[model samples]
Target: MAAGGSYGAALTDLGERLVGDVITPGDADYDEARKIFNTMIDRRPAAIAQCETAPDVAHAIRFARDHVLPLAVRGGGHSVAGMSLVDGGLVIDLRRMDAVTVDPGARTATVGGGAIMSGLDRATQPYGLATTGGRVSTTGVGGFVLGGGAGFLDRAFGLACDNLLSVDLVTAQGDQLHVDEKEHPELFWALHGGGGNFGVATAFTLRLHPLTTMTAMLLLWRPEAGPAVARAYRDFFESAPGQVGGGLLYLTGPPEEFVPDDMVDTLVCAVLLTYTGHEERARAITAPLLRLGHDAEMITELPYADLQCMLDDPPGYRNYWSAEYLDSFPDQAVDRFCARASDMVVPSPSQHVLFPQGAAVTEGPSDYPLPWRGAAWIVHPFGLWDDPADDARVRQWAHDTRADVRPWSRGAVYLNFIGREGRDRVIEGFGAENYHRLAGVKALYDPDNVFRLNHNIEPRIEPRPAGR
Candidate 1:
């Protein structure tokens, strides 16, 4: 609905009823409210409802439904394809609802939907508890967990959705539900990897694990050694313990103390190894890679939360990314994966990463909609750069990276690692059977497809007999 139409009047009423502020296009914070993490996505929403509580979310949903306004849910504003924000629609901004409460006794965390990885990490750290979160601190816990989260701790703790105990969400019909194993079982099942199609997750209760001393190590090498390094990294994961996680990435070496002077501002390959124990154990586990590394190294034992921030990518970059889960990372495939790094824009936040996926990820529940977990390795190209002129350059590079690794592609993919490719890609993310099942759940809760933003799952509509 247009902002100047009946929405202007209806928006006023909705604003008064909401506990949070309702921001319109002319409002002081409208621009900031609509702004998301990806700079490439520039959209102007008609209204933005900054929801504070669960009731506020329901009210916003009802208002949007009543006025026939497109609805988008924002959590940490971190959707790479700008799924968090909608064009000329009403955004249910949940950034204000970020409050994480940790229960040390149960070793579970009840987090607000707006909570990011930092908030979650900080809350659970004092209790010596942690869960599978995103690679960086800025990623929203809701999007990450709902979309099948993968992080440095994933191999040890399993994907974020695997650790889900319960979820409190607001359906498209403006009804609040406490979904779990017992209550709303199907909806709970769909939440495993069913992005934001089912509903808006207002809160999440995640199972946590004990994590005391965590260590991180970065072994760097020149771009020429990428193929060999990739091979070694592939072999290392064959017997690597659950505590061993992280990726082999091609990135421009930053001007940090650990980066060599000559290698700075040039593309280089780095093997990032993260362990759930002390520095000694981390070194002992990754000793093989360290022996071959020559250029630079940054090894330190830090808190799990602190380690998450180490590779955090700053926002406000023109971002484009895609991933291809590999059935096998053969030496020839490794060469293709490394060769694509040359197409990436150097001195930017872009990373051509090959992450190992096995251990708990494959051994976990096979019933969930997540299909990419079974893959041996994941080739993800995360492209973040400035200047609109380089938009085509970075996009082509990310696309080419996926194409190069397609020979080893395991049919399925991780949706969270990529943006909206197409309907076929969405089906590829969730297997055919799981996709249909998730669509059935979508038909039940969001039949009208009110929540069709993130890697959308459309409701199955039965056709009528002949002409009406």
Candidate 2:
């Protein structure tokens, strides 16, 4: 709809009933409101409804429905493909609804949909409790958990969705539903890794685990040592304990106290091992990789919340990323995986990561839509760079990284680790059978596919008779 007459009038009327502000193109903060994490995404919505409550979300949904405007939901706006923003549409901005309530007694956290990893981690940290969160603290809890969250604690605690006890959602019809194992069981199952194809999740109650102390071990080596370090890292994690989690990656060595000056701002291979215990135990477990490392090392005991912020990617960088779950990472595959790192943009936040996925991840419930949980290893090409000129180069690097390791591909992927690949890849994110079931749930909640963003799951529509 055009931005005048009924469209403008509808927004004005909707704004009056909303508890939060309504931003339009002419609004002073419209640009700021639309700004997402990825600098590559530049979209202008007709109006943005900064929703503060579930009722506010319902109102925004109804307003968009009544006006026949495309609707988008924004949490942290961390979607790499910029799925949270739509051109000439209405965005239900949920950033204001970020409230975290932690219950140490029950070992649970009821997080607002807009809450980021930092808020969730910080809230649970004081209680000596934690849950599976995203790699970085800035990630939106809704999208991350809903898309099968993987992080440093995943190996020990399981995926974020695995810890989900309940989710408060606003359906396509602007109706609120409390989903959990008892109520809306099918929808709850889909929410495990189904993305936002079902509805707008207003809040989530996640199960938290005890984590008193955490340790991070960073051991770096020159880029040439990637292949050897990759092999040793892979072998080390194969038998590593569940309490151990992290990845071996090729990245620009940051100018930290432990890093050598010559290695700073240069491509370096590093093994970041995170242990869910004190530094003494972490050092003992990571002694294998410590032996092979040459350049620099930093091992310290820190709070889980503090560790979440360690790898937070700076915003406003163009991002392109893809992941391939592997059944096995043999020596040949390791060579290919390490070789592709040379193509990555140096002196950038980009990382060619090889992460091990096992322990609790494999032992978690198998009935959910998350098929990639069975993979032994995950190769993620996380591309973050500032220069628009290197866009094509960085993109090709990610694609080539995937192509190089295709032989070991496990056929399924984690949707949160990737962008908008395609319909087939989306199905692969959730296996074909799980996708079919999720589509049925989508049919029940969002038949018209109103929330057709993220890794979308299309609702199954039964056809009418020939002569309607």
Candidate 3:
């Protein structure tokens, strides 16, 4: 079987025996298969094999290794960088393998790598159980967990990684390995936040918590009150209990029913709050924020699943996002945020989000390779528009806003939010020691580096060189 070419005969042989769809560049669904959530990234892979089982992933990994082809792994395909696809490589797409098995008696859930937040939430909601997941329902469980996951429940349960119990992965050598704190411990630790450098994770057994009712709301204020609102939000988050988690977003008014017709499209400061405690106590916990002067209030008691989808953005909308971690949201930082926020030029609704950091995130730096544990806020500047022509404007806006606030940042960026930058940013995503450690583990599990498409950490034979 010839396996040396881009579209090798070996791949064809493997696809024939596989149970999933094999998408080639000429296929009718290829365009949709290659499409990602971020409109800014458009790449064409040589082929995309949507895996249906762990063995299917193993087959894809073996094919990429034998063919010496660049490989990308797609879970939810929501990466801002679109690392899920490569220009001339094989993409082991996992979107079709989204299955969730809940062990409610054990308080655990074993989820397929391709499962999205909504799928997992729906499966676990019947038991009133959930783990830390992305705020948006569409985010994938695989990439989000492998990178450090933050969501409305993070403050209470810690990151998604903290709840991870075990993972089923297909290594570069085509052998399956089950990793956990007790077995293959180092590899497990690296997988916590090391991105997709180690292997293709097929499924994860995660610890779940009982999550019943919670309070979720969006509080809006005029632009003039930005400074005061920032101050109030900063103070409130400083001492808020772990049960409370959310962010303050500086955004243009939405042209929806929630806002009055006259205020539509006007700039405003919106505090998005979610408290995962008893419904009655949630009010008291968020009292400081709710009291801040605002133009409108949309607070309500909702189930955890409903709250998860409350902020879902349309799938195909154009989006450009840049994120950073701040040591503190001091008055100076707030001033800078407000200054750049005031200059948002996109007529569409763009936003600057300030998410609180700490609580479980600060337990230990060694727990996960993810930096920014001590950060006071995780700032994300999201530029949204509906037209391809406006793509340049939104991209530039996200970049400029990120640059404007760079000085106040902690020199740390969220791996999930990073785009197609090179190795330097990848190394920076995991601090030096963690990066080196992850590299060594990557070498053991995937020496050929078949999973080179993400924020890659090159597999190393020995420890990383001194300075690198």
Candidate 4:
């Protein structure tokens, strides 16, 4: 069952048919190519097909099926669970296909499936247009959008999947399909938040909006200010305009010009408010937080693309992330959330975050299988560190963070926000009814469940008669 030449000439024939490089174990870049964002994942795929075209993807899919090799699709390779890789299988590495084409007149952008948020943001920046993208630039557009993407502009623009206009995908049977409202409509609905259970998307055309100006304001305080800051932030953000998006987080203070020497390398509380407008308007909306006598502050008006990279978490750190959606952030919930910050491994890239969700996010289409979108608040424990000794501790912190907020929990979760919890949680993410419908779609496009490396939705198979 190994993915090497044991499949005979089929492996060699696949290499000949592909328009991209067929990288194997002995290749010079195999080790580096196999690396993903999470340092803890050390998988070795038998063959890494760096696909550059739709044909390449189709060929790779057929190759894996013919050889009976486990198939994994790699876009940004940012899956916290390392879903983009397989230990001894074939990987459809789409990193080389990253490309972005913007149509300012039409207010839309056609993004290559492998394109990252940074590429999309930069491409649209010149046209004063953008869509909801990931919090950081490195996130894969395919996985982000398909999983109901959220970001600094989500409250203003809506989830990335909300902006999806069309998707060109290759199914498990090596069939190419252009899915939208008119064609393969059932599959289109599942694509809204279904992750990658259906197929390997080659490209996505997304609706873009005018975003000529953006402002970012960061107010920092000592770790002790977490509870008060969290409460005030909760109250301020609840009524703020949709244009305002950001969160309160506790992170190890970086050695930056805006960070105080005493705060650097120590856990510090920060309230970042991003406004999709000019600095003056952002300042007006964030004045309440500014008046809290922050020990350090930074306010700037910059392009959205520039702001997207400001909080980019460095890779090569062991990561374990999980989130809890809340109906309301009451004083008790705020206290519990703040209390968990003490458990975080300080001086690392970890962040204990509280994000507000409402406005465009809540008002977005309800038909999509994004049950967590209605939640008013999201408590995210994003743990990243270097030492394996802290593995148990970091993972426990994330789990305990979720447990702390269970009282006010909305009972639904964002699948992209957490690693694999269980099948029940996955069903909860898309609701029972929606999951049932998505399972049907999975049955149509991928009945054999070829693409099961995501927040997987198993194909729903019906029982047949006793005898044919």
Candidate 5:
């Protein structure tokens, strides 16, 4: 659809002078360029410019603006809602710019937009250093950081944005600028948790911490013990130390080498715990969790990088994740969760995960654009399936689960997990005050709203009504 005329001519002219690949629909790699992490989403972008430099990104932006084409920025192409590709639009793929520079003395690393969690971790692990990142290794640092990343180290360090030292971004006007606490502080604040609505981030400098070995474990309990397991997990997390980070989930056993044949398709509740501390100390701290009436306890000490990738799910798997922040996990809610866990289809492997929040994540809501601060827990209903025919069933199940838990939630959702729900949901994600502020920042840097993908925040030329 976007293969000819002035748009194609402009791309061709730029490609001749650029260092990266400019692929059109007719190209052999077009299919791969358009493919994102979720196989359920099949999008065909008109053109995908794999950028190698910031100037190339700026050029792509200018070309898109000149052609009046919808633009999607792809950094690892892992958006749950598949916002990284727009049919017949220009896709600026940053995956080619995967450069990383580490400042060991300063404990900071500057990563290119295309860098994935695995790449970053590999680079930093040699120095026994790490930064806040997503749990999965394939997750792109750009999207994860911009959306307020949470991972194993979050409780010890903070959210990914909290550790961000600076970022290089290309604006709608084809201008490149460095943003941080000192320069363009407002834009920097918005970039932290404002999703990808501000500008196209070219690179990020993140603060890292020394992390050597950590104790990580997967404790599995039968479905019948869901209630007891949930209660114990809730109580343990309520008073857990800042060094401890874990989440509870109900899932069907994976067909792995370690899983018994009988348990392969059985419903089970699992607790994933990771303690970033000395081996002995971590074992002592998590001893109670290992003893929590589980059918199995698979605990071990491993490198931090290994622990980070332990939960990596394969790409192309159909998934729908919905989340809500809870003030507290009430007894009734626990009962409901247990009951729901027992009713799950044994072979489907759908899950309800509750991640505890406090300390690093419970700071003032004003500290970042992300709302839902101080919420005790984040409940995520994750649906996974491979059958195209069962798509509706999986999606509806997640939706219903989230709806059922809404009454006890903080009425806010995590941007990364939200789908194409609507602008209203986007507003609710960041709260009124924060959303308006983010909109103002968006207007100042990207007046035309060039970066409208992700959980978009509309540019505000004037002040909005209170509680908008």
Candidate 6:
């Protein structure tokens, strides 16, 4: 948190030029500006520049660099590690920049860096066009896409990054550049699964797909049925088409009509099958699960945007999330996954989910940083609860789930699903070879390593020629 002697004076000057407000520790709204999605993370940044334009972002970067304060970029403000918030540093808050412009003819959407998933989804939904976005509506589009977005539609449309067309970036040195496959090819490639290591992305152009109607079938059963349901779900996904996507989760059932009174507010296993097609066809394809005889059921066809918001976790809960991608989910693994449900805090928003991966996810671009896409299954422990007392138990449950499934692990990490585990996991997220390549790109754009918050990729310095 140290800075040079003139840092305080320089910050005063930097705040004067911005169209958006610059919030410091003394400001009445400072605490509000610093709040992120994860309630557990509380950071006191030296300043928060709520950027209204890319130029504003560039200037903030310049000022932070000159003052020698660490920099953190805030998009969606949903980082579980709270990477978007830095302690006693500068934060480039992009929430004000959210604006979505869609080109139905071109099948693409250009989104502001600060926009959330709902903004992009609502804009494109009117056109009967869609894209792969995060499962939750409130998740920031910038962070989700940059971290390799995956959601209910991912199996059908591919990960959100797979649909990315271009990005507008503001480098650590305050240079603005447009990167696409044609321009800054290597830099464009790094954006695939690379965390925000190179720069602050001011905007993104993403490809869109046609999705007229989306269907979801939620079937639930008692906790004792989890092992059976898990095994059946795994078998079903083995041959299901790419349009079939969703997860088998152990959660406390909500007070829905379909949910039995006994199951409501109690832990139960649920299988959700999301199909990109219409209701009748989707139901026909997933009839096997329908016949499994669940304690409750809810099947409906809804707008893609509406489906995205259905699972929005209520905000006040403390969160601790993690994931482990698996090479295969055998019957034994199913039992282990089900057993971990006992450790989860019952009647909470916690979910012990097993996601199937394949089809479009595995068949997508192989060279991208998403090496974990090839895994057959993903075990995600998304924990949320209201009490600080349950913090230790939630953390332990996530840790134990990863440990229990270590044998089946493919040794890959999904950067978005897990919190900041360590440097080694970051390297594993992108394969070692891809990590090296990303480091080189990081060196070129961020040689000084100004953006080191998110699953950071260290810059590799290239030596000058002997003649020099």
Q: Which stretches of candidate 1 lie over 4 Å from their true place?
A: 1-5, 462-468
Model 6: per-residue Cα lDDT over 288-371, one tens digit each:
888888989889999999999888977867899999999998888888989999999988999999999899899999989988
Candidate 6 has an lDDT of: 0.91
Worst 10 residues of 4 by lDDT: 1-10
* TM-score, structure 6 vs. true: 0.97
Which pairs clash in model 6? none
For candidate 4, the TM-score is 0.98
Compose the digit string of candidate 4's lDDT tens values, residues 335-366: 99899899999989999999999999999999
Give the runs in model 5 whose Cα sits over 4 Å from its true position: 1-6, 342-349, 463-468
lDDT of 3 by residue, 335-423 (tens): 87887786665456567888997787776345588876667788888776778877776677677777766777787777887676667
Please write out the lDDT profile of model 1 over residues 1-468, one tens digit for every residue. Answer: 123544788888888898888888877767777888898899988888889999999999898788787888999888888988888788999988899999899999999998899999999998899999999999999999999999999899899999999999999998999999999999999999998898888899999999987998888999998888888889989999988999999998989987879999999999899999999877888888888946888889999999999999987788998899988988888888888899888889899998999999988999999889999999889999998899899889888888887988988998988888999999999999999999889999999999988898999876788987
Deviation (Å) of 453 in candidate 5: 1.8
Check candidate 1 and list the clashing pairs: none
Reference-based lDDT, residue 230, model 2: 87
Inter-residue clash pairs, candidate 4: none
The CA lDDT of each predicted structure is 0.90, 0.91, 0.82, 0.92, 0.83, 0.91
Q: What TM-score, to 2 decimals, does candidate 5 have?
A: 0.95
TM, every model: 0.97, 0.98, 0.94, 0.98, 0.95, 0.97
Task: Give the 10-residue window scoring lowest on summed lDDT in candidate 1.
Answer: 1-10
Query: Which window of 10 residues has the lowest lDDT sum in candidate 5?
Result: 1-10
lDDT-sorted candidate list, best first: 4, 2, 6, 1, 5, 3
Q: Write the per-residue lDDT of candidate 2 for residues 1-468, one digit (tens) a residue.
A: 123444788788888889998898887777899999999999988999999999999999998888788899999899999999998889999999899999999999999999999999999999999999988999999999999899999899998889999999999999999999999999999899998888899999999999988999888999998898888888898899999999999999999988989999999999899999998888888888888847898888999999999999999899999999999999999999988889989999999999999999999999999999999999999999999999999999999999989998999999988999999999999999998889888999999889996789999876888999
Of 3 and 5, the candidate ahead on TM-score is 5
